[model samples]
Target: MNTEAEVREEMGYSESNSHRLFSVEEYYTSYGKIPKLCKFLGNNIIILWLIVKANKDMHQLVYQKMDCPELLQEAVELLKETSGVGEDVSATIHDSKIKLNEICRVIKEVYEVVAKGICMLGKLCMHERFLSLKV
Candidate 1:
């Protein structure tokens, strides 16, 4: 897997260089650990757009919160090992409030099939995680 610095060096750009202008595709394809993880997690355009629009510091904070790089690799490996079966599934998740830990557990345990179904049914193109908010 390419780290942010490697990708930046390959593309001849980095967050440190603000003078150069680049397309959204080029920008997201080249920088940041979170952007790299987002690409691996399905590469949804809206999510990428959100990431590009979000504050850079917030993304750094998320990386700190999630213990990134490590979490990123684990997520990619987990997704790879449990390739989606594309089964048909439907349900209403009713709750007064959903905790982040519970959401994380569901994501780790059960959302795989549901996400596959959503993609298979064309209801959603893909699943995306934007961790710009404080975790």
Candidate 2:
């Protein structure tokens, strides 16, 4: 787990403003309200795309670890139910599962994809593009 300082540094927030950020509990509380959040982002394609990419990256990480199948499954289910598409989401979940079943998968692939996704999100946030979206 990253230390608070490490997390702050990675997010490029100074120590003085770190205290204004959400705590773990607050973060989880926000996560728990994702259905509403999804509704809120209904008109924001860019932010929605970022979320989908992040979810895909997370699925890759979970697949590489093979240690949190339940969590991954739940995430896929949530994505399917909230994405406003039944058949396509099912197909996507199936494809992701098939990839996860590959015999010689490399962990580095997951790391690279996740890192790239995070970098993209960071850039978007840095430019205030994410904040400018209608929600």
lDDT of each: 0.44, 0.46
lDDT of 1 by residue, 1-135 (tens): 555565456545555542232333343333455454445445455463574568454654221233456456655655653553211111113455656765555554455554444333331111123342324
lDDT of 2 at 84: 35
TM-score against native, each model: 0.23, 0.22
- Model 1: runs farther than 4 Å from truth? 1-25, 28-32, 35-97, 108-110, 122-135
TM value for model 2: 0.22
RMSD of each: 18.1, 19.2
Q: Write the per-residue lDDT of candidate 2 for residues 15-118, one digit (tens) a residue.
A: 75444443544232134444543344344344556677798788653212222564466455445444433443355466556454342233334434455555
Worst 10 residues of 1 by lDDT: 84-93
